[model samples]
Target chain A: MNLKAVYIHIGWFQMSVTNLIIVIGMVVLFGLALTLPFPGNSKGNKKGKGRK
Target chain B: MSIMQEKEMWTSKLRKSWQKTLPVEKLLPDTQPAYVASWIYLFGVATLASLGVIIASGIVLAFEGASWYHYSNVGHFINSMHFWSVQFFFVFMVVHLWGKFWMAAWRGRRLLTWITGAVAFVASIATAFTGYLIQTNFDSQWISYEAKDGFNSVGIGSRFNVTNFGQMILLHVAFLPIVLGVITMIHVLMVRAKGVVPPIDAFNAELGERK
Candidate 1:
């Protein structure tokens, strides 16, 4: 891969498309990790006993 | 205390502290409370997983030497992996840090865990800075030159010597990573010892008052 395919350019800073994609992908993944409810989420017994 | 009592005191105190703080079941719990299934809870493990990838890729890159990545495709690929892994690690860690902060995970006297994790985040940034400095490229040179004035003004430039390739490489590959790893281990152990913090709502409900 050409690591220098600049996708975003500021005055003295440049970000390659590849790196930008990776960062965007990570953000999406983090969003999903924070918002998505999984199967393990159950409103189980609310007993406060036996917890450490 | 008598001599025998004094001798027993050390061992007895050690064992007692260990048992009370981290019983076997708590250390290796098979079942977590349903609340643990929250997506935010997974970021801690995700950060760890990305760190693992970063370290593994770093080891491979180290064996090939620093400049080899510029010449060899495999080396470049591994280097890219390492770079991306570090990015992912930071992203996940920051999210986890924010999530825990919002949840007040430091509540319930897990202050040490929170402190260690925050320190680990700082150390990780330092490690990444050193890693960038050791890349042996124009970018590294520019970064080092740019960063030297900041360190010098802070009276740390002489000690850290960001421009020194050997020192930077050593810190990037060894010293900083070791410190980061140890802090991370302590953070995880504290989490295991203290158990996951309950949600703020649960905590407030348990206390019978809105906090």
Candidate 2:
């Protein structure tokens, strides 16, 4: 894929590869966020110590 | 009770109700529970930040008029910021919604909070759809033409004329934004009132201990 080139265009509105990458990156980040455990729930805090 | 005493009783009742539902400590807590220090929790804040940017950039765009973005470099930059902020807002909101759903966030009498958040998400979609129709570009024209059929099939086309630029612009800049804002405010207030839902394991642990 031409990363610098336009990926889609409608009239004057256009989406480039960069835009696609940013959007995909954000989606992936959000997905990854779902799997990560909260700090308080992690094994280190399983005993409920070291928490406010 | 005398009339003056009755009035005082009513005022005190309101004050007590407010304090009971949202104590000052709960409303602005200095510390959050450990489980709240999670990546998923951050998505809600991220969505709020994106909304702030979207609104600020949209204000600038609105002041410059619909066509100014196409003609001026600064306007184009601000417009792009507004566009991307909206994309980020939806992405974050969906992630937050999914995370909450999987966590069963409606537990612990929090169904109202969940419902308010869900309603806010739907309102945000409507706000975004109107925004697309007011973009003043080929995308707007094509989308209006295409969306009209869908609206007509749903029997709402007559009520919402997407082809009418004036109507779309007003909905985009004024009415829909106000609706989204009010809904979002209620969602946040509900969250504050209910407190964050505890993890299921914690609930189970408490139940076991109680037993």
Instruction: Give the top-scoring candidate (TM-score).
Output: 1
Lowest-lDDT window of 10 residues in candidate 1 chain B?
B198-207
Alpha-carbon lDDT, every model: 0.88, 0.85
Q: Candidate 1: deviation at residue B187, Å?
A: 0.4
lDDT of 2 by residue, B119-175 (tens): 889989989998999889999999999999999888898899889999999999999
TM-score (C-alpha, index-matched) for candidate 2: 0.82
For candidate 1, write residues B1-211 as lDDT tens digits: 6867965787888988899888898899877766787777888999999999999999998898999999999888899999889888988998898788888999989999999999999999999999999888899999999999999998999798988999999999999999999999999999998888877688576778967
Cα error, candidate 1, residue B95 (Å): 1.2
iRMS value of model 1? 2.5
Docking class of 2: acceptable
Stretches of candidate 1 off by over 4 Å are: A1-31, A43-52, B1-9
Worst 10 residues of 2 chain B by lDDT: B202-211
